[model samples]
Target: MIFLKLSYISQSRLTGLFSLVILWTLSTNTWAQKIIRAPYIQLAKSNSVLIRYRTDQATLSEISISTDGKTFNPSIKSTNKVSEHTVAVSSLQANTKYYYRIHINDQVALGDSSYFFKTAPTVGSKDKISIFSVGDMAAGETQRKIYNAYVNRQKSNYTNLFITMGDNIYCGGSDGCWQEDFFNPYHAGPLLRQTALFPSTGNHDYDNQAFPYQQDDSNMAYYQNFTLPSQGELGGIPSNSEAYYSYDYGNVHLVVLDSYAWGKDNFRIFDQENNIQLNWLKEDLKATKQDWKIIYFHFPVYTKGTYDSDVSGEIIKLRDYLTRVFDEYGVDLVMSGHSHVYERSRPLREQYGLSSEFSPEKNWPFNSSGRYDGSDKSCAYVFQNVEPKKKGTTYVVNGCGGQTAAHRFNWPHPVMEYSLDKRGGSMAIDIEDNRLDAKFIDEEGEVLDQFTIFKEVNKITKKTINAYDPIELKASWPGPANSYVWSSGEKSQKINLRPLKTSTYTVTDTQKCLQDSFEITVNPPLGTTKWEELIHQPFESLEIYDLLGRTWKSIQKEGFIDQSVMDGLPTGQYILEYRLKGKSYTLKLIH
Candidate 1:
């Protein structure tokens, strides 16, 4: 009986082991079936959002992206599987919430209820926002480790938007390499939690496509991963096929182009016979009019190291043809990377090199402005006229995001102003109505460099323009030493004071310089005071004055007594000092 029991136990153990093996085999098959893996995923940069991811296989049985955890529906047309089986999610609503999932054919592979994205707003949207961008990335355990620092910096800061200036991964750079090099590093970071990543293609991006060489591959990974805006003026390729695209943010418009496309068939960027990209660029530039315009690409036109100067074939061709266009319109700045260094050019053009107004003897016509303390910062020979001209666009190359290559500091561009090649860094562009400021920040979040691009409002050209006779006020009081006080209680940028009340306020400080008194008068709000009730000389108009004998302006039945004005004025000291009751009644105006 004991021997029979032992046999039964042994049989049970065999069955259990067999069941475990079957379970393991099924799990392994499921993992292999997934075409995409290590998805270093992100949304787009500007107003649009592009989703990027890498796959584990060359060709998948089937692949699709679906909203949240929903099943893929072919009729929706939202899913796209591109070259190398990579995918991009595009054409989403700006400043909104979205959920998504990935699928391999009909089998749902990765489903997370929390996978979400928010698109940026179009121009004039008036949305306060946050964004991020980095450049010069590569594959390595070191890059992987630094990536965590990047993710942490992003999570705890004001970077809601993300942009990558190519070189996202550095495996041998295939779809498989991107999985290992790019996505695997930060696949689980907060930056991925909720952010959009706008990526520009770099030289390393086209490493292994069917094209003859790296330059010829056309960045299949970049195109496959990000779904870019295709419908607007950025034409040349299919709407979705064109690597170049534009998106608006508040009052800013950003145009992203594939620099490698212009990088010459035989390593020559400027071929008159093959002007395909140049033509497309002209059309694209003529199409947009946001308050500020910024362009991003891989090869920089101005740099202090590596491929410096526009003479580097591609840079020269692009600069010669495109710089004029950017100036014709109001492009605020242009940004590029791939130098493994950081450099900034002064606002430049054919005429102005570096200094705007300061004219040096050598550069003859174009001289730096010598006006501001004679420091020679003006790139005057380029754009400055007797009157202020629309400023030239400044170009910046912030390529040191990550790379094994080092920089040699010999700058070549005549307009180049600042250059640095050190540890990795990033740039932050702060945009507002009046100005767009670019700040270069290092990995440690220390500000390495700073520059401001002041937006110049172009002259209004119209058949008939509405004009206002700027409210003018005149005051003449005692000598130069006399202290002069005016009403409205605020200091203005202009030296001459102008008041709309037609009344002037003047107070003399005997301890100050000379002051010449003029026909000064103060009037109360039309409704607040009865002008006819006040008695005065027949032809001489009556006037009112405050405690310091300054005219308090009043017009159109309203006076400057809002909280702002009242806050500074003394409450018990002010008076309705009008000659109504035969004499001026010193009435206290409450705060």
Candidate 2:
């Protein structure tokens, strides 16, 4: 009986050992399915967000999101059978913060406090919006410094979105390069995970080939990695393709174009007349009811950087083709990055010609200082929003996010008010009410340049005056002016003008550095003596008077009145007043 019992105990122990081996194997397998790339957030709308990640082996993806950071009751799962996973979570609140945890095959991967995102404000909301833009950002310490500069500068300030002005990945935008150059530096790090990215395609991002050529290239990774707002998913007209699209954030309408794809000769999307992208842009701009209109692309319309828009065929073509559309649609700002330098133009208009042909009067109608520096009391470029025609659009080339290249030609373009090629930097823009404030913050955390554009609600008044009337012209402004100069040689706030001939009087507020003009025309008095017969319509009442305020004649007559009617009248200058049904006309006539 003892031997039998010992045998039974040994069998039981063997069974226990076998069970431990099975548990160990299961644990090892779960550990082997490691998360190779950390999860990142994208496509952040007011009510939804897309979470993407990758693992070492094929595994299902799951995510749990919570607003309070604790009770993650809402869970999302992806059914795609692959290592790379993307799961979209929807039905969220706008302008709210959310905490999330990533899971691989139902196993927790990331459940830390750092994994959180703030949803964009509801569309058309009056909330103040801020955005950070960088271009050609490659993975390295330099890129980190630029990002850190932005973070340190805006520590207390939260950004609504982050924009990449193309060349997102360096040395061919492959999957590996995207991971190394983009994900690790910007996403895996703390700066970009919270904000959604809106990207434009640079030459490198388009694989150095045109869009048509890239359609068949299986190696093109940009389309594979990014889930952009095509099909009018966010707002504006549907672009139908990811190559070019637009979105609305708060009061701003942002249009992103594929400059490299459309700028090339063989693969150009615009033919100076019509194309899908051009037509889409036209319709999109026409449909946007937003207060501020901003457009961004890869190639610059005007720049004096390494790539000259004046000489390059592609750049010239794009500039000549795009500016007319921008002007027609009243675009407020044009942002681009391809020159690898920081350059900003003054409030410019009608600059579609060659660089040599740029005229201050024609291209730069608003040539005042756009810098917010207190040297000039005018801190912002004010545009009256009443007119369909835009006053001007400020073109900014903020390409120094990761690298800086010196200007090969003249350092400054004719329309440029500020140009800096010294160091790399990023751009931060804040939109509040009708004012937009932009600053170029360099890697050193210094604001290299700053400007503000204010959309004024009030309209400028235009007036016409008769000569010899001595009309008092008053400058209608709310603030005190240091000096005021009228084109008619008057240097006072109010000027009495009695011009003998037609003239245009331009008033310049030297303190505000703004100019406004009005025109006046002179007319001679009616001559004495009857030389011509009077012609009148049927049932019209006519009356005649002299310069001495003496009535000559009054009659309700029809048809032509011959010279016989004035035969008995005294030879003197006279005024003829004609009256019709609910209408009256005054004419200077000779008696």
User: What lDDT score belongs to each candidate, Candidate 1 first?
Assistant: 0.48, 0.71
The candidate scoring highest on lDDT is 2
**Model 2 TM-score (2 dp):** 0.70
Per-residue lDDT over 315-416 for candidate 2, one digit per residue giving the tens place of the 0 to 100 score: 888888789888888898899988888889877878897889989887775656666455654446778756534488889998878867788776688888
Lowest summed lDDT across 10 adjacent residues in model 1 is found at 1-10
Error of 2 at 366 (Å): 2.4
Error of 2 at 347 (Å): 1.8
State the weakest 10-residue window (summed lDDT) of model 2: 1-10
Screening candidate 2 with a backbone cut-off below 3 angstroms (N, C-alpha, C), the clashing residue pairs are none
